[model samples]
Target chain A: MTGAPQDPADAEACPVAPTLWLRLEADGTYRVGLTTTAARRAGAIVHYRGPVAGRAYAAREPAASLESEKWVEHLALPLPGTVVEVNPLPTADPGLLNRDPEGAGWLCRVLAGPTDGRAAPPSVPTGAPE
Target chain B: MSLEPSDEARPGRLPSWRLLDLGRCAPARAQAFVEAVAVSVGEGRVPNTLVLAQPSAPYLSLGFHQSFHEELDPGFLERRRIPVLRRVEGGGTTYLDPDQWFFQLAYRDEGGGRGGPEDLKRFLRGPVAAARSLGLSAELRAPSDLVVGGRKVSGNAGGDWEGAHLVVGGFLLGADVRAMADALRLPHPALRPLLRGLVAREVTSWEEAVGVRPPWERFRQALASAIATEGRFEARTGAPTPAEEARFLEETLPRHSDPAWRELPPAPRRAGSLVRRLRIAGPHGLLVFRGSGEHLAAIVDGDRLVEAYRVGDGPTDALEELGEDGDGRAAVAELVASTPSFA
Candidate 1:
């Protein structure tokens, strides 16, 4: 699979936080998606979830959501940042990730950096890999 | 500001938060009340609050994540004066009436944690504190329920909004235990245990608690005190903003009351199974079946002809199909007929 395109123009687009397990690739790019730990705690995936383009998100805020059979849970941002790119397909069929989470399930991309310089996103605690 | 000063300098105790006693409104109104309260707080138009409303007639209420069939006899409820309504939160079934005083709290999600457990704890403390304000000792046992002296007084449930707005509420007024027991179709396993032991332990009301019918004023006083102390509310009254009201009505209300939305099971494979011969006969002839746990898939007509077969291995689709238009049997028949010939 081709690596996600890196665009300097995308970097300054809008801010979003990582709602699941995600990080910045060493080449100054972002890799954001849901964590396995979060999936189990939420029970089962039942409905649609995705993100909005051109919208800024704070760290730990939900840019998207996944519904279980009974309840729907939001995927919070892992790091404070901006959305530079988004895969529109997941919103139509969120279960894709819930079913085969490790691949083809990545939710969105964000330009990682604190907007307004309030505070950096909280680092995931040890053993917090859910 | 000075820590202490003359009478003018010292702020007097705030008056108790005003309570809107919705005395026996129609089922629709009871629902409207919930929507009004939720929309008001959810959109930040209203501060934290305690809303007490009593529907004039009986109604079956289901939690956000609850299945309608699990708790209510829809036909029976419809036949009777009761209305079957759904709420925008999670929890078990609650049977409501004039004798019961419904308590609701729409508040900001200020809990120090996140997810179900965090929200549950944050929401529960409000009512327990309310009960305490009313002069009753209350405690939150394991999970997300409130109890007084081993007997449950209130049950609470709600979801986190952006991990910010969380609405948690329950019934504190007296419940008609026998009627509720009868109206609700408790899952057999749960019922069997209740019939045997916990049933006796589950107590119902202020009457049971204080050995007399609780004075409405007293209950109100207690509820107000608790909410004022533990929750946040402005001393103003008005309808929720149009945007918030529209959202609740559009997004929240329909999701709750629609049977198709309410009873849709999460997964078809996990459904339970049972076969019962209704007294009424059907054109398809006598039915017999082999089903997956709870889903009816293949059935034999009177002559033992395989009349129905579901194409899928599990009941996920069946969950959505169950109560919709009340065509569970037809869907079952369709499922059976559609199955591959070998099975």
Candidate 2:
């Protein structure tokens, strides 16, 4: 979500639930973050927990939790992987997720284990990596 | 987070809504039951469902994101022996007792709303209709509120739970303004009366609006019918599936019982000076004020800078309109010193 190539371009494309994305890094690591729709629906981010750095998750398994003005729910990972690099900003100040969700607010970096990325939610858009 | 349903759904006909009327449950159980429903719906164990229930005792249910310390006065809660729990949904902090009848809805994504405007409409339509069914003129205040006249009759909040959408709100069958104020950690003593007056003025219930508290069975029947009609679902009396029941006892009840869980999510360490904004005498205006002893800054009618005596921990330059002389400014600040008002 933060610094990777993800999909679901804008707010209008998102609904109440978070529309998430998985961006594969050059080193084959992966990043997961929600789009603007989830951030906006969340209103101001009050608290956020980054995915655990070493926890392995099955594909589409929720990796973290967040609370906004709306509801508290887990942030699911679209790919099966072991969490590697946890973004520090949103962990310290959850508001970053609202301000720059697609950039600094990306949930975590994961070392992809398996799956061809077919497990992502149906509406996830494709993004060109920066 | 997953629960097994007692029965699988019929193959052909699907209910637009499944109704569960939990007439009276222990205070904590009443509040936590909805989480069970949400988990069931999210996991496909149950379809869209609506639940009606009331807590036998009084307690404070805070929003998921609300800071427990900032929103509550611990001394008061301890004195009253009231247990506080953080609800899964988000919104304002609320006080609940047996007199209040609550409504909760869990909708799966099959044909459900995606959140935002559509969700708000879906959230309040049934409650608004139920209020009207009782012969009160009720309408929705955007995002989530059921208002009658200009006062809010119901407090509501909605959001996604796993793969399902959940909305929880309630109508006060009685008014307890003083208790409501006493429970809050007021920023100032003066705001005490203001909050009392504000809650009494802005929040209304069946007892206050109608001559009598709405008869229990009658009101709930109307609620079920109205909710079913709004969603175009058939209303039928149903009990919680074994899974929902199991989770309520095994999970939610125990978690809410733990005192640490009540204060589990801490509030922010430092907060900016907050403004207390309350509706003024007129419907179109607001009185927004912020300050501490001897100094205050206020904005009346939204734009007028009525006074600028304080901001953060110290006094600032007073409004020039009152004159640059310290004497004149001090005189004005003292006149409205105790509370922010129009005159």
Candidate with best TM-score? 2
lDDT by residue (tens digit), candidate 1, A1-130: 1255433233222243223555455566476666555555555454444555545666554455555422445455555566666664444455566664544766667676656744322111001001
lDDT for B83 (candidate 2): 79
Candidate 2: deviation at residue A16, Å? 16
How many clashing pairs per prediction, in order?
27, 3
Q: Report the lDDT tens digits of candidate 1 across residue range B272-321.
A: 24222210011122122345544343333332333332222342333222
Please give, for residues B283-323, the per-residue lDDT of candidate 2 as tens digits. 21223244344324333432333433332332333322334
Top of the candidates by DockQ = 2
Docking class of 1: incorrect
lDDT of every model, 2 decimals: 0.48, 0.64
TM-score between model 1 and native: 0.54
Predicted structure 2: lDDT: 0.64
